[model samples]
Target: MTELGYRHGEQHTPPPARRVTDVAVERFEHVFEVDPRLMTVHVAQQLFPNWDTLRIAAGRADHLDWMHRHWAHTVVSGQELLDDITGADADGPPGGP
Candidate 1:
């Protein structure tokens, strides 16, 4: 028997739950055409003010740490934003062009 009362060979595994960051990344990428993995803190703060508020209210330190790790090493540029806004060619950089 398992913790959930299932037999040893009949344990049921639940489907993986999507993380909040995953959804945020997907939406941010879809709208901005940028790899959200490379988003800067300023950009993330601007784009996800609601998420920030929720994190603070919920006291989700883990989520806050995950967000920091998500955008730890990259910076967004003006030219990249312009390219995305103007529908320019897609050859600028890893996250945008």
Candidate 2:
């Protein structure tokens, strides 16, 4: 584990705790569908590289920080794409204007 908080063979320093901001609170508001485990998994994909899905999001501030830095972009983009697809899917086939 390094300052980034990834698991590995040798010992390393863990990153500092993440602090909550109003922006994060606002962004996360109404985003109940995304699983907290997903955050750790996604952050692992980006920042932690070789990590697995065993990390927890509740007490680990480094994971949350990495998630904010890296995962948020993917989440927002994915949500936007899903929203577009959902909107289109909800509409019936186009009739002649």
Candidate 3:
């Protein structure tokens, strides 16, 4: 018997549970041109805290690539926060002031 208290000849393996998360992480790669799996979840979360879209929007070209790969249009803000396609350093908060 193991820690799970499984007896001999008995398959104690539990079934695979659904991947549930409340932090709202991106799951799909919208940019089909590029491979999404290239970036791992750890790196994504590390580079982008809470999978923040603003970081991706204001980051380098590669970061932008990550954004698209993670389904930017759906996972994050649903293509609503994109105010300026052109990356510009503006004062005050994003889309404000």
Question: Top lDDT: which candidate number?
Answer: 1
Stretches of model 3 off by over 4 angstroms after superposition = 1-59, 74-97
lDDT tens digits, residue span 5-68, model 3: 5353333322222333432233323211112244566455232232343334446657767978
Give all candidate RMSDs, comma-separated: 15.1, 13.1, 15.9
Model 1, total clashes: 0
Candidate 2 lDDT at 52 equals 25
Best by TM-score: 2
What does candidate 1 score on TM? 0.17
Tens-digit lDDT track of model 1 for 1-97? 6456434332232222333553342222122224445576657523434344344545655775677689767656789888786664545544652
72 Cα displacement, candidate 3 (Å): 1.3
TM-score of each model, paired residue for residue: 0.17, 0.22, 0.16
Q: Write the per-residue lDDT of candidate 2 for residues 1-97, one digit (tens) a residue.
A: 5476535552232333343442232112222223334467445433332122213333365776778898576445678877877776778433413
> What's model 2's lDDT at 63?
71
Candidate 2 residue pairs in clash (backbone atoms < 3 Å):
none
